[model samples]
Target: MRISAVRTADRFLPERLSRQLNPWLLRLDQMLDGSTEHAVAQRVSLIAFLVRIISAAIALVSQVIFARWMGQFEYGIFVLVWVTVVILGNLSCLGFQTTVIRFVPEYLERQQLDHLRGILFTSKAFALGLTTCIALIGAGGVYFFREAIESYYVVPFLIGFICLPMIALGDTLDGTARSRSWVLVALTPTYIIRPVLTLVVMSIAHAAGFAPTATAAVTSAIIATYTTTLFQLLVVNHRFQAVVVPGTKTIRFGEWFAVSLPIFLVEGFFFLLTNADVLMVGRYMEPDKVATYFATVKLLALVHFVYFSVKAGAAQRYSELMHTHDHAQLSQFARDTARWTFWPSLMMAIVLLLLGKPLLYLFGAQFTDGYPLLFVLVVGVVARASVGPAESLLNMAGKQKICAMVYAVTLIVNICLSIVLIPVYGLAGAACATAFSMVFEAVTLALTVYNRLNITMFVFAGRTNARPVKEEI
Candidate 1:
């Protein structure tokens, strides 16, 4: 296919048309065929974007099915519980999930195989152990607080706790795989395989005479989560063997933990900030309302997934560049990532708003009420994409402490606004609070990157005149 394009360009294309098409075609060919680091990163970003697109479709279809099967109230309960669990599971890594991404590249670059082997062994063990303990404690808390909690949510929360350790392990494995730029290995299990498995398991359970309640839904999630995570564990471990043969492992517990703790704060606050709106809505509204808001949020993922795709591909490359102390390349790549993130996200956001009503109706007729909120919510998403993955660049550049501070301030603002706004404005208020918070987060992170790293990361920042950072190497 590339050859055909190249041949046509050489033989038949007019001068102006050929001039316009040739550069892009050449870059596409290189992205497909080149062996350079830049080519590899582009390929990973392209593949990750494609995977996220597929994942979004699968998720949307499955959520619509769940809503149809269980009704708004029960589906709302399930989504609330599931979102909480996912956040906790990712947090349960205590930053090791991301820490691995930072350190693994450093280890491999220095040929510190013993430390590499040690970190690989310890990160999984630590996350699994910590999360298991937390899950147990969570179960105990639920048991003790069952009297005060809503009876409908009680069973599902307990079931969600049971899935926590596996979720944590899966996340850690995902980071390990990503650190190696094994894009498919890193993404497929969590994104493609797990969602599909969850849908299949839920269908099987429903067909087997189980009621389509949140409890039943969560039980299906447990089976799917365990099965998918175990499969990922095996694959990541097997792949690691080719990278580093087993030997005497050197565990740098103090150093690893020190690095990971600040990251824990950054990631924790970031996750909470991302989901706090849904949680706040769940707190102040009925289950049906929660379902409506969640459905709206899910539809907006058409725009949201663009940032995540660019982020997933950019983080490891940023880490590599940071370690190399290549200020010029790092600055340019950061700018490139912002462009990659913003334009597609803007396009998707416009498309999502255009289709918002019909898409909401897919959930249920009542969900169309949330359509007006899309306009409010999309402002934040586009504002955020304008900075691309600025937080990622900061985190990779050893500036996570300040990044955490930025997210912390944003989260506080979100919660306070939600508290003040939700009672008065209801779901519209929640949307307003979230959108404002996202805009605040984006502005702060972009400013922080520029101040700390001397890198102009905004999507619209002029490339030719980008400020140069001091070289650390």
Candidate 2:
């Protein structure tokens, strides 16, 4: 009887051990899954996108309040100045951020630590030096036009001039963090925290006996940008060091520029393409008219953000897949990404369209006059959605030059259309031009991806083509 009892006890012991160990094994699986680079990028991008949406909501309120307080004329000046800054700031980004996203991941994958470190350092330096020079040139141009420019606009533009360096630096840091899949760390500073803090500061300033004007708002933005970027740099640097030691590899300035210049042109042309409509309106129409158009564009931007969010997540994965020549998986991932970007963006467009009138009302009754423009603008957003984040897939797969060429052509087409249409149709014509140009850009980018990678970046009929590639991922 004792021997029999011992045998039963022995058998039960193994089962007890497995029950104890299974949870730990499950935890290990999760950890391993989380460690994949694609997983990290997707997680970070989604988190960043969510945070960005919240931050953008707060900013929208502030923009409306700020615009109302400043009155239509002052508000128009502010928008013009702000748009100019945005255009220049993006151009000055010089594709370092874009270049970093591509090269950093590839280098890290190949274990080229030196090139990795060099690229990061070089990219940041390139952005700073180039943007600073550009700002100085712009300031010089402003100085030349000071007599022709408004007295109020002069000071605000000058204040905005100071913002360029930090903005450029922040963009470079953002790219670096993204490459490493540090989404919150990369985006929180520039996108979420900075805009929120700017609003807070502006509100306090208004209450504390300071005149509520574009100057105060612009000043608040500058302070917020500097503070958030500095903090981001410190935290990102610490995390950056934790992952990989700096200076373990040599810096290659030459190679970095060779890649960044074409990319810079790509980004620059795209920026020009986007801002051309607003710019032409500003040139030909009254400030009040420009304000109406600008308001509509900002409202539609929310839908566009969804597209960008998916691209943020998909880009790194696309790069990694391209490196492995995993055509089958790449095709599948691109299709899924397209579906994800499109459906959400379409839903967002619908919701925003329904709420468009009220949201425009936030800018004041006069501002709400632009509601029809929302419908025109939304068509572009949804049309772009049909194709997904085509530019990202191209830019990631070392096809940025082709993307740039496409954007350049589109920009030229947009300008020509806007010039002819704006005079004839006014705001409606401007809206039409923008929508037409955007749809063109989307179609061109989608074709570019297909031509370069042979993957369909659309939602329909993707499953039938999911056959395995000859090469492994």
Candidate 3:
């Protein structure tokens, strides 16, 4: 009883379309439930990718308004202040936020809800206290040595302090949310709502004929940071109540600190390596030059962010795979994750580079002057993506000490190169320094992944008679 096919002028259209989409469909299938571990990683990574694109767009628009409203000098100050707050705020998480994404997922997978409850409260309390202390101490030290830092950064630096606690608080909420796969809850407030709020507030200020300086911009940032984080806190709390008991047993504070300390070092060093060039540029060059250099880095960051988003998604999977003790499955998951990181990243890099000049031009004519730096920065990004988030492999594999060492060495090299080159080659020096340091980081992460995990962390994924990476429980 075969049914007759209905014929039309477009009879084979569905078949043609499916044929065209089959590869993507197969890839999607591979990404989903190729194994439970891989599926989790792929889904989180995909969501992070989509969210970051939205975030990047919102951030780009905000910066454009910031640049126009503040003028070059004032805009440069805001960049410096904003970057400072971001680094410190992320740092102030004390590694607990990201650590939660790691340990909570693993503990929960092991049905260690008791431990998960402990981590939940412990990480938040510790991050809150630590960052608050750091901000206060930093402010005190700055007050004492007020004559030390450059004149322009003083006010901006102080203003940046209001954000550190808020940022750190937001990060903890993000980690908790992501561990549970509440992607929107984890990302939206910080990435989307915060920027939108910042821009809206600043626009209102400018509309009222305010000076619209860095101070004004920073006031807006402070408002946005607190507003979004508080909102996230309330929403996350509501969700938390449904899943976790209010009176769950808490882990020992000492135990929590012990686990987070190494992670703290790893994160601190990583932050230093990533932001060293920008910090150094601000130190050596004028504020306006910093604005240009930061703009260039942001332009090239589209590719870099892909590698990061993949890392964020895959790190948890790496941890879960380690728990399985199945070498074959672990290697397959590793290879699949790496492959996911590479080809898509390469395509995205191509697209970003093509549009980079125009985006830089969005900052204005003087802003487009740094377009040449994009090529220099892109090399590092492509090279790193070539290895497919190798750093995550090391971090999740209990090689945080080695990771710290590698970042330390790279940061020093970056600083020395930036200092030497900037005086001679200007912004090109900073770009060159950043590229070289990133290449160094990729090489270090590749070796760590290879020696520790025995997987080839590279663009090329097939067999090479690779040996298994050894580690202790």
Which model scores highest in TM-score?
1
Top candidate (lDDT)? 1
TM-score of each: 0.96, 0.89, 0.92
Q: Candidate 3 at residue 19, lDDT?
A: 66
Q: Give a tens-digit lDDT track for model 3, residues 50-129.
A: 88888888888888778766767888888887888888888888778767877877777677778878888877777788
Residue runs of model 3 more than 4 Å from their true location after superposition:
1-35, 464-468
Model 1 Cα lDDT, one tens digit per residue, 1-473: 33646557868988888888988877777777745677777888888999899999999999999999999999999989999999999899999999999999999989999999999999999999999999999989998999999898998999899999999999999899999989899999988998899999999988999999999888888898999999999999999889999899999999999889888999999999989999999999989999999999998888888898888888999999877778888888999999999999999999998999999999999889999999999999999999998988888888878888999999999999999999999999999999999999999998888888888899888754445553323
What is the descending TM-score order? 1, 3, 2
Q: Which pairs clash in model 3? A: none
What's the number of clashes in each of the models? Answer: 0, 1, 0
By TM-score, the better pick of 1 and 2 is 1
TM-score of 2: 0.89
Query: How many residue pairs in model 2 have overlapping backbones?
Result: 1
Give the poorly placed runs of model 2, Cα more than 4 Å off: 1-41, 150-152, 463-473
What lDDT does model 3 reach? 0.79
For residue 455, give model 1's deviation from the true position in Å. 1.0
